[model samples]
Target: MLNLSDIFAPSNQISNIEVNKESAKINHSLNVNVSVDCVVIGFDDKELNVLLIKRLQAGDEKAYSPYKLPGSPIYMDESLDDAAKRVLVDCTGLKYVSLEQFRAYGEIDRLRRAEDVQWLERTHGLASTPERIVSISYIAFVRQKKFRQLTETYQATWMPVSKLDDIDLAFDHRQIITDAIRKIRRDVEVQPSIVFEILPRKFTMLQLRAVYETIHGEKLDIRNFHKKMTNLKYIVQLDELEKDVPHRAAHLYKFDRVVYKRLRGSI
Candidate 1:
């Protein structure tokens, strides 16, 4: 739906990044066909958000509006895990993000679309785009407020998951996001501690319940939720209260990882 030529062009910043990549190489560098894509999920009180990127400008070309998950071709010198981390930092300007590899996406017709193929050819300057690209995907659910420093070679934006219908994403990124959400749901079921990864260090009980309700897509009974939370020995109540809020301050609670691990060991 967007012009490919307009969306991608030779840029100064990219050349800088290339220099950094080359600095590590002593000889001619060879790259594998694998690429790394990251799905960074964040939670607001009411809904979930996803970190997406789009071209900053098309220069003279007509800029497109569609976005893509932050990713890039992996370096031969780096492991997949290291590639995920490096690509995230290079593409998204996120200094740190702890990612877990969840899936590998490589369809026979992965680069069948004209826009996608053109994107590959333009950005990577491939004379002939590869027929297939194996995407090693990584995911992370982290506190949004903690990582506000996000910018891609293009630009990064946090869009809500519920409103994803509003814009377009390149390639099979939509499917990738769905898979990440599905995995998060399954992992939360097996280990409730996974939910804490998305939350702040100190949180309110209502805020905790909100995260649960948003993930499950249903309202929870407040009484039952509170009662069950009381049994979480690792959820330590604190004297601290939420500051500068419109409503009454609620006492905060912190997760005790040591207690949680010890309890898990005993059980």
Candidate 2:
């Protein structure tokens, strides 16, 4: 008959070794590949727009024709946020801008074509397999004037969001852009900072109302709009009025810092 100690010793040692091996494998698999794409949005002349760049490549006749969102794979030593900023600067010459993470896509077989696989392999030397892409989409709000100046040299252009539905965007970017716009609109209802991106530094109450109406795609009552503005106290009178206009002059207002802080918390 075997002793109780001898019987338990081998089983306990084997279980400990197996647990350690499993832990190492779990740690290795946790190191996932991540990529970042930026959906840069700007508002110009009462129209909401997104920035797109034409891809440049050799042996591709239509390389500079179709536009796509600026994107690149994350480096081994870099974070996703850093990779996004690098792509924006490399493609659009914009830097130090604020970006919000909108979504993460990790569906297997997201890339469908052999050319797509080849392109990734050539550009980043990444093994193009159908394992998992796992992209992080970011949204950036930049002033229209700054955006234009920075992206003037590249084949980058500001496209109206309303016209996005009919066009075909590279990658799964159309879906990303649509989601960013929806999130922006929803943020506008809660956060006053959203208006700062769309409105001029100094604007009239009527102009502010117009911006809200345009975003919501609905008309708002002037009287009720005024009441909401007063209740929120997010804007301050600049003691100035609109100039060079044929119609009656409207009072110019600026965003109030204190009011913004108060409303920000509630939002």
Candidate 3:
């Protein structure tokens, strides 16, 4: 058994993580041909955030803050989707979240960082590493409210995508995040309901507008946005108002999934 005290620096920084006793064990029989990486982004009503794990360098506990996407080398008998789901469940205790397999990244220098490569080799106990490890990446955006507290058994935590430039990331994880953001931006354009996935069941028009503005990286005219929302019959207005907020409490609204499904079927 690996000594957690010596291998890990004592950290209280909680995310989808705590570097606790629940650290995963290596499956000696992993598929060397391909691995799966997952990028789960969340929206906190104001800023968009991405889930990231602190990857410690092998034999160097002092070098902390090397965050990376929560991922894994696929088990010998597991499907790519299964592996992606496993990564999320292991790292964040999240299940039943929708994830899209965006694209494959196979650049030869994708794992050029020595510490990153070392972490992988040691974590997985790979005596013989693969010459070329192609990554199958998946992406999703979840509601921030779902993860308000530090989960007990999970591995990374939410980091605002805007602050991504401020930290040290491992491997091509930064590029993966950039690509994931681009994919989601385009997805929301094609399907507006994707926005509701990260929003609370009850929300305000301003909250709705902010999600779009942040995702698209621009300011949307409020009047025009409200007008557009009025046309979207699936968005139902509720009698409740935002509670305890300092600002004027705006009327609450919720998405009608039944109506949305009906309308979407017609289209």
TM-score of each predicted structure versus truth: 0.83, 0.75, 0.79
Q: How accurate is candidate 2 locally (lDDT)?
A: 0.68
As for candidate 3, its clashing pairs are 15-157, 16-154, 16-155, 16-156, 16-157
Q: Give Cα distance to truth, residue 234, candidate 2, Å.
A: 2.7
RMSD of each: 6.0, 11.7, 7.4
By lDDT rank, best first, the candidates go 3, 1, 2
Candidate 1 local distance difference test against the native = 0.77
Clashes in predicted model 2: 0
Candidate closer to the true structure by lDDT (higher is better), 2 or 3: 3
User: What lDDT is obtained when candidate 3 is compared to the true structure?
Assistant: 0.77
Report the C-alpha displacement of residue 251, candidate 3, in angstroms.
Answer: 1.9
Best prediction by lDDT: 3
Report clashes for each candidate as comma-separated counts: 0, 0, 5
lDDT of candidates 1 onward, in order = 0.77, 0.68, 0.77
lDDT of 1 by residue, 13-60 (tens): 232245564566532132426788999988866678899988433462
Q: What is the lDDT of residue 168 in candidate 3?
A: 82
Taking all chains together, the TM-score of candidate 2 against the true structure is: 0.75
Better of 1 and 2 by lDDT: 1
